[model samples]
Target: MMLGLKTLLLFGLGGQELLLIALIVLLLFGGAKIPELMRGMGKGVKSFKEGMKEVDEVKKDIENEVKKDEE
Candidate 1:
């Protein structure tokens, strides 16, 4: 079943295209380092999201404080 599903997806790909992409990634980062690269990517994205959340909270608090000062 798994093999059948994978075959269906690969049916649309020509051999050399996949090979070219695989070679590029291999050259950029060796086989053993890809997982660590992906993990760091995930952490960077998470940190960016948290930073945005903190900025938004600070903006909201400032707006509330300004409103209180006006009243």
Candidate 2:
């Protein structure tokens, strides 16, 4: 699933604006913490994708059962 916040953020941001934001983040978090933050984000994304897949599977199973009952 697409992240709504990500889509909303940076929608009309230009290159200069992006650079400014990056610089601010670097100053706030420092260089060393950025990698750790990105790694954690990656794990979160992976978990979210897995959860979505399971939801899809359950939905399909429910639909199939309903179809079988109709026959």
Candidate 3:
């Protein structure tokens, strides 16, 4: 069975639980900083994705080199 993102991240947390968590975050960070935090998170995720792509390209190159050697 393939577990979806909600199942993996939320782990059965209901709407009320999500709302409570959001409220806590709002209180701790305040509304003004939320946008900045989200922006930083977006940048971080973008960087991580780019890094993963580079790693995959390197792995493919290595595999191709091995195949060339074997042939």
Candidate 4:
């Protein structure tokens, strides 16, 4: 299981491979646009996290209500 997890995380990528990928992204997006792209991605991730937290809170509330009814 650990080995599988490691393989999934790295996908066997080495330093050179990662550097090449970064270069490709820089070339495709150019120097000026990368920061904007990253900022949008960061915002998207933050929104996703907040949505997940709200879902978890609602789930806990429902569970608590169920417990109250049982009592």
Which lDDT value does model 2 have at 70?
Answer: 100
CA shift of 28, model 2, Å:
0.6
Q: Which ten residues in a row have the lowest lDDT in candidate 1?
A: 1-10
> Which stretches of model 4 miss by more than 4 angstroms?
1-9
Q: How many Å off is the CA of 5 in candidate 2?
A: 13
lDDT of 2 by residue, 1-71 (tens): 24644664649766687689889989999999999988999999899999999999999999999999999
Per-candidate total of colliding backbone pairs: 0, 0, 0, 0
**Segments in model 3 whose C-alpha atoms lie over 4 Å from true places:** 1-10
lDDT of 4 by residue, 1-71 (tens): 46644774577776687688889999999999999998998899789989999999999999999999999
Give a tens-digit lDDT track for model 3, residues 16-59.
78688889999999999999998998899789989999999999
Clashes of 2: 0
Candidate 2 achieves a global lDDT of: 0.86
Ranking of models by TM-score: 3, 2, 4, 1
Tell me the whole-model lDDT of each prediction, alpha carbons only.
0.84, 0.86, 0.86, 0.87
Error of 1 at 28 (Å): 1.7
Better TM-score candidate (2, 3):
3
lDDT string, candidate 1, 1-71, tens digits: 46644775678755676688678988999999989987998899789989999999999999999999999
Stronger candidate by TM-score (3 vs 4):
3
